[model samples]
Target: MKITIAYIEEPPFGWTGRDQAAMGADIELADVVLRAIGVSTIHHHLTSFDELLPGIQEGRWDMNVPLFVTPERAQRVAFSVPVWSIGDGFLLHCGNPKVLTSYEAVAARSDARLGIIAGQVQFESAKSAGVLDRQIVLFKDQPDAISALRAGMIDAYASTAVGNRVLAESADNAALEAVAHNNGGDGRVPIGAFSFNKSNHDLIKAVNKRLIEYLGSADHRARMERYGLTHTEIDGAIISQSAKY
Candidate 1:
């Protein structure tokens, strides 16, 4: 009858607002879906990105805010149907003097350094694109990475294209900008969904049922739009989920 969800301070997805209440697209989505599934009470626990999976597996929370679904992660937790599909991008100082548009571009320049949150998929993406270990800097969270980018410690900060855009706009500084990755031939975007302890089959099933009926609804789209998500992201998830499930 009650569910506690873990979330990180990732804007446009989840964050603690001015009022100290959890807010963002993913938090709202979780609230709506969980409530509809008959959860009488809901709790939001703020945690670091690295802690989300282990915390859930330890029974510290019942669910997590949407995160990218990876094969390795699927082995540890059960994910709800995809909620959004998004591509990666970079947060850079305004003017982008280094011309860093993609991971490959950064790799090509020995002087270019990229910042990524520790444990994020971006690290692997950067490595696969030939970025050397010395060219990469890892941070514990988004704020730290953004700080490094602003301070000239890192040439670019890699994260979701949508999240970087929102962060750039909210920064209220003319010195920050976001550039979508040039996926080139691949053109594939990663999909994200709520994750739960693998053993909690009943909870996952109920939430997935409600999520299926709610994800692409008019109300859902409108709510998400307030948090900077568009049909491009929302509809993509619906389409991807349809094919997979």
Candidate 2:
């Protein structure tokens, strides 16, 4: 059987490596789990963050792995058990002058403008933190949002913690710094999972069963460390009640 997986180039989760190879913890996990279930071939479809769900819904792919499992998303796709738990992070100008570390901090500042990728979970987290719609500037992707921050168009670029770390450490972003949680409320950790087209229940069930076993194994930890994920990040993993099969 063949399985087509849709993914975006979000560091630590999904990205093309130096040799133009598809890589990242999520991809490896998907490969292992699918192959265990008799999937003879695996094809990865590189897509934009905005395209993940729509691609699945449109039958462009069999699954979208490693996306945050939001209730809104669950309505459109069948999400498997949580594969990882993630929190919000920010890419801020050097020195973090205002000491802005969380979404609550940004919300408290009337002059603050936050750059967020359109359709990302961080957008909703910002809103939940009392950030006004006007204060939240939506961008098409993380790079664009980070550019706006460097140009002073926005105070900070909001995204996943590991993602922001990758951005801050990249050669082009040496002037920026990363912080762990932007939501300010105990890390706004949300469970992430593989998204299957709603009609693919059989595939979803099989993947979920294997995923749970994989996540609890030492192999997953090895993958996490190899991908630059921190110990806290691994420990932060949580199961989502809504995502359980």
Candidate 3:
């Protein structure tokens, strides 16, 4: 049977429009899973990240690709196994002209605008750090926040380190640079793998079985490396899922 995979333009995670060939680590690895299972798929790139789940709910798509499943989201949708993991990152102007790294630095510079997804962990970190509300501008997606930063509407964008690297290195994002604060895995900032549904229990099991086979393989490691997702401070498949929601 042919499965329709609903994906976004999120780089390294589910890149399609980024390259003419629709190539990405997730896509590449997913190809292996589909081929092994004799399952055919037609990739449908959604207009926006917000559309990912809605499409699934609407029955317009059967799969959501490379999505990070937080505990809260798991309630609304059935997630398949997480395709991979990521670390939080800070995207700043070149040279980090502000020399900003941690939340403390951001809070100290009241003049600087901190861009973050409203309900994301980054915003929670800023909140916990005592960063004032005015200093934080909520965004719908990582790319939007990055665009705002480039446009000078905001001073910095916070997201998974993987996103920071993708945005900073994207030919379109020449002015930005990724700042890795060594925060991943630490108690301060924790991230984890993507999530899929128990709703598709069979599919999830099949994916997990395939993933298990790929675990120590060179190809699996190489594909992930290409996505800029090096070793991360990710929480467990189930535990971190609970906290982020």
lDDT of each: 0.93, 0.82, 0.66
| Candidate closest to the true structure, highest TM-score | 1
Q: Residue by residue across 133-155, what tens digits does model 2's lDDT show?
A: 98999988666777789899998
Cα lDDT, model 2, residue 25: 81
Candidate 3 C-alpha lDDT tens digits along 147-183: 7898889888877777788768878888789986566
What shift in Å separates residue 50 of candidate 2 from its native position after superposition?
Answer: 2.0
* Candidate 2: residue 152 lDDT (0-100): 95
Error of 3 at 244 (Å): 16
lDDT value, residue 188 of candidate 2:
47
Model 2 is weakest, by summed lDDT over 10 consecutive residues, at: 236-245
TM-score of every model versus the real structure: 0.98, 0.89, 0.80
lDDT of 1 by residue, 1-245 (tens): 98999999989899998988999999999999998989999989999999999998999999999999999999998999999999999999888999999999999999999999999999999999999999999999988888788889999999999999998897454689999986668657899999999999999999999999999999999999998899999999999999999
Which lDDT value does model 1 have at 94? 88
